[model samples]
Target: MSKGFSKEFLWGGAIAANQSEGAWDEDGKGMSVADVIKFHSKIYVKDYKKQMEITSQQIEEAIKDKSEKKYPKRRGIDFYHKYKEDLALFAEMGFKTLRVSIAWSRIFPTGEEEKPNEKGLEFYEELFTEMKRLKIEPIVTLSHYEMPLELSVKYNGWEDRKIINLFVKYSKTCFKRYKNLVKYWLTFNEIDSIERHPFITAGIIPEQCKNIKQSIYQAFHHQFIASALVTQECHKIIPESQVGCMLTKLTTYPNTCNPEDVEKTLIKNLLNYFPADVQVFGEYPVIIQNMLEKENIIIKKESGDEDILKNNTVDFVSFSYYMSLTESANENSEKTAGNTIFGVKNPYLPSTEWGWQIDPKGLKISLLELYDRYKKPLIIVENGMGAVDKVETDGKIHDDYRKEYFKKHFEQMKEAIEMGVELFGYTSWAPIDIISAGTSQMSKRYGFIYVDQDDYGNGTLKRIKKDSFYWYKKVIESNGEDLE
Candidate 1:
């Protein structure tokens, strides 16, 4: 008997290998695009584009530079070797599920490998086994931001279409290896983010493409095919498994009642839903196709590509909702930072230190809107606040702000659930702070468990529980009824 959720409600946290696992090149792992994305200091906070884009020359330089200090993701709090200890802490918190992504390069090293990396397969097997031992369900994402750098360099990543077969190969290997261990699979982490950061997400460097938008859409088409193919394989390999599509849900509103602002906001939201529509409905939305045609961006699909997508729709829709955006037609309107895009400031809302607006009510709105449209079981796979935390002299990290963030969002989630949204689960963006995906800084902490590491990659790699850790543990024990 829970307050609002079903008895089997999933409550836990999420992390990606590229952000948490060090050992970047260990156990026959090759470089990923994430390895080449250099970490800039706080000066580049507003210039996130500079952090995500990597040129061929820069990749060559990164290959020559062996220092992990320059690229912080290369040494991500050492989760690669310390997952046992970390999982124990999660188990202590009564985590029902933990969402993690499998690094593609770790399994294939290069995308062209004839045989899968045995060591990488063994690592995840042991990981899933440990989670089972701890009574924690695993929700695994096949591809996060980390794609094999070799594929990016040789085939320009997904744009060449050959990478589709390669990704399918990698995915099949994972499915067969972990068939009995993992039951929940997400095809891609934030699949919609390809347009915002193409180089990192899809491995498409702008310099290599004659038409950037065309290449972006072309690469995305390939991913849609790959995702469908993998979903088909996942179903065949594991009958009880549930596969989903991940989106970075940037819910937007008009700044005013002006038709211009409302119309632009409507267009922006429609474009945002195009990726999920293909995954859920098994076909490209008409609006997205028309928009592509008007932009002169052609997606060259294979003969049965449509059939593959149409036949293999996702069983669930999972998304990350960190904040909301407000659109305005006036160019001089106040603007603020967000996950990957900027939007006009909402005077009614407050923002994080990174200028991402905090809007718990928007989460409810997003849930209602997505459910009404897709009519699918929805899971919020990622949601959490990134703030500057302090470790008191007593060695305790008091993160009441983090607790309050989750508290408000949980209240709204309960409201949405009670309002007839088929909401299922929630996995916080991270239970432990790893590396900032945008700026590659560790200072932007989002974890209930804090790592001793700093932005420059210094510290003992120790984990300390924050005040929110106990708060969240209670929330889970009481099943959404004990926020107090």
Candidate 2:
């Protein structure tokens, strides 16, 4: 293994508002698109060509039709009400930082409101204060796939340029209110994924925009402007704090040693980086622009968007690297049944029940590549293995698989650090397992401390420390060397 990380390395857990905090309708919180989407009961199989063919209008029309049966409400775990206890559990795990997001609707209620909601602001204030009391730094995502339903309905979400100004207003409020406590901020979580899954991310069905690529590009345009503008605002308001953008780093590997496979891998890498590179590097990659122009989908730009992105790049790059994908030109080749954009298979790797490929080495590759390209300190905002844990009759979950998964990943991270990747921290996803994002169930667990719950939503709302919990605490305490 490579040399261990710096002694001052931060170790913690990452979660989002919509996923863990299940007060979907409380304290004036507006409904988000997540509230309406059905959970995936079975593993999501990817048909790459079919997924590629799906347009924004097609998705939007399906949403508008509303003939689909409704799923159960995701009001389980109730982190809104249980954060105090939950945070205490996090503190027990020796967390140096706690990554979470503030719900947009909770803070703004209406996207364009002149005055913010005091109660909404107060909820986060108390949450942050609790973290501060425990000496845990707050890593805040300004927006995490949770937008006010009102915004999507009235302003067409990020497709409308007006939302940029409103987003800035909300971000500024977060800066001013939590400036003292929040030292790290992310403008948006997985901005690229949101563009890819707009109906799921922002609730602005693609039908509203008439064109998928145009809608996605337009939505991304506004998000880029907002992220850049918010970075500038945070600097102005909180000079000491660092602001960044978070992306879902679904790393890709070549299907074979063949040059064609390598070339396909490179193309997929470029496609993954398209949204973020444009936001951080200020100009669109020539290939993507050429493709858009060929397709006649021009992203309309406002006056100062380019200048904003050019002048205000994020201070750091953060991402969640759960798994990797292997790419090939042959579409019919057997692939892992994963929930990735390029749903190709990795011949050499095993996969989780959910179809995500298990690839700890990909983490090291991702860190090296991102650091080389951006020349900025990297923060791994989320990395964890999601699995079904069997609770023993004694009420303890061994979870050795989780322990082994993280151990290998941490070892590789040590290698990346020695290779000169300036890593700021590593925060595993779901320090305490909450609801699963894709399945909207607690069964697809990814936490060190497993909460007693299941797909049918029946179990004591009990929190038990899985064996991995103690295992990770030791690793963190030793600065990533103590793994047994």
Candidate 3:
């Protein structure tokens, strides 16, 4: 039998600042790219192209908009006000690590600033202090789904080379301030999503750029450099700190046994892994370089760019693994939607309410593949199913489905460990239900502890424990042995 979770394995949950902290403009916080994203209906949720496209007109309108309800991210579950209560709940569940992101806009309201907002820095200091008090190790992600809105409108986001220095400045400040508090840092959350949702990932508006593909890849290059620079700075400031690259691990499989389908699947999987390859391996893969040349996408690099990446490679690999996908060469293949990615449907796998294919085995496959490829410690930062949760009159939630989902995934994780994967940690997608990142809806819940909120941002904002909460608590207490 495979060994259970290691004694030092990080058992916790993950949440982003933009998706959870609501005080949009309070206490010197500036607007982030996520602030402008309005909640669309379910009909438009899966329409990735339409949902991601942002125009100058939309930007102008969103800037002047004053309705927080329309933009649910503007007023998240108010984690700003209720973090103490939330952290207590997490502590009750015996959380060892909690993955949280710091909004760049909060520190540097505008992308370019001489000094960070003191109030913003102070806020994080208090939060991190609290986490330390609770003995819950804080794993920080410097950037999640958003950067400052000012950068997008004025500098055209990461497409501008100047943004690279600004990001490095912000990261240096973080490393210096939280040197003792935070030891594990991730440069960006799902760095691969820059191609999937440019607006959300890098604040790049497609219409604003002259060459869309070139601009996107150029922006990606800047981020890659930024991540490396930050990793380097973390080493200088906090020698013991470990910095890792974050990727959206969208594992893909062949849709059929056909050779064409198999070839297409291989390419698709490589494309998804390309970004991480650069981050962890410290060089762009040959396949990606060939794609850039074929597509005529030229990335302008300044002096030391190549050396920066080559020298400051991440210490570990962290990723968000919500679902897997399949690819087919056939034009008429059936399709499904996932977390900002879609692929042909797999006949053998079941899907969640959000259309994300639920293949527990995929987790094992992804771990083995990533470990084999990178030979580094890996952490599952985000993995959970979002469902429309219901509450009983007695104030109880019987979410056997959610419990089973984690149980199966945990079993697969054990299998991978037995197979010799150097797994570091497992922080579930969310310990508390926060606003959905892609859809920006609260109803699409993925928390063991439910938050009383709705799609329109109206609720008592009460946090309630679900049945899975107890299940997870036992799993953690027993170190993954007492799943039943």
Candidate 4:
């Protein structure tokens, strides 16, 4: 047997609102950036630029098109109505906590409204109350790729700096409203992904910008200030709250021992850590500042931006570790996509069908490094594989592949905890199948409980427990002791 996890260690699952909640226009909800994105066929899912590139024209057309047939997110497994049943299923799995995001547009509609939407507020109150009854803690993310579309159109998302105050208002309303329901808050989901999917992450339309990188970095600066301000307000509203910064931890390695490859890996790693470094350390890394200067990208800051950031550093760090990436200096090296990045593939590693390489050891490395650097309590907010599961004739779904995936990662996590890393929790990316955030494909599922839905949004919308569901219930019952 392994050293095992602490009794207080949290074991649970996570889901984002925009990916699971399907009432896009119902109950005073407004259009979010996620609502305008269309689903691509499985064959074309790997075309990153085509899949994510959003234009103002596309937004206009999407607004006019009322059908959710093309846009899968608009019909996200109908979680808006089925949440009670979903939460009960999670409780049955012995979930100690559940990480979920609030749809910003649901509360503020166009994000400029003076009054909060009562219907939107009511929905979450009911949801959280259910979790409390089930003895589950809540880790709430304020924004998770679900920004109001009006802000993106009028102010170009975070580029114009006006979004800072607007976001603060929205966050303030949430804190005042849900103070008792939520004890843990996250400012953003994958805060480092602003550049990967610009419109989806930060609502920046590339066609409106003269220089994409400048606008992206300017938006990044605004987000930093906004995050700091939110952190400050969360502490004031709920003194016992533990606010955190979230990142997509893409641990990179040198393809070989060559000095050139090592240097390339180092640069990649630095950029990967830059976003979290700013949040955790309360200042920009000197190297990143120098790089920004060389690029002639100047961030226009307000008077007290530095003080706000320094005074309101995160209480803890949370991140998603999907897989590890390999770096090489050779431009001709074989490239494969992994967690929103294209990198040289590691031959020693096995990759999922989506080309995400499996690297369980990378989780241990990430935990140790993050704990050593910040010395802050850490939590794994998102980590799981997406795959196609087969339902047998008897209506049982046997997903042994996913079970094996989690087993290997859990063992490595045990090793990390034994080595004295201060990890407090582990929440899988999703406990039940939701719409795929990257491609909107229902077939590429990651869930212990299976949702009956197809890629084009056609199914009975039934819920079936996969074999991993029972296995996970046992693991949580044993406190991460029963890997078999």
Candidate 2 overall Cα lDDT vs. reference? 0.79
Worst 10 residues of 3 by lDDT: 40-49
Candidate 3 lDDT, 383-458, residue by residue in tens: 9998989999999999999999999999999989999999989999889999988888898989999999889877
TM-score versus the correct structure, for each prediction? 0.98, 0.93, 0.98, 0.98
Ranking by lDDT: 1, 4, 3, 2
Question: Mind sharing the TM-score for model 4?
Answer: 0.98
Instruction: Name the runs in model 4 displaced over 4 angstroms.
Output: 43-46
Greater-lDDT candidate between 1 and 4: 1
Model 4 over residues 355-386: C-alpha lDDT tens digits?
Answer: 88999999999999899988999999999999
Local error of candidate 1 at residue 302 (angstroms):
1.5
Per-model root-mean-square deviation over C-alphas: 1.2, 3.2, 1.1, 1.4
Compared with the true structure, all predictions reach lDDT values of 0.92, 0.79, 0.91, 0.91
Clashing residue pairs in all predictions, respectively, total 0, 2, 0, 0
Writing each residue's lDDT as its tens digit, candidate 2 over 141-199 gives 98887787667767667888888888898999989998888989998888778655775
What's the CA error at residue 151 for candidate 4, in Å?
Answer: 0.8
What is candidate 4's CA lDDT for residue 302? Answer: 79
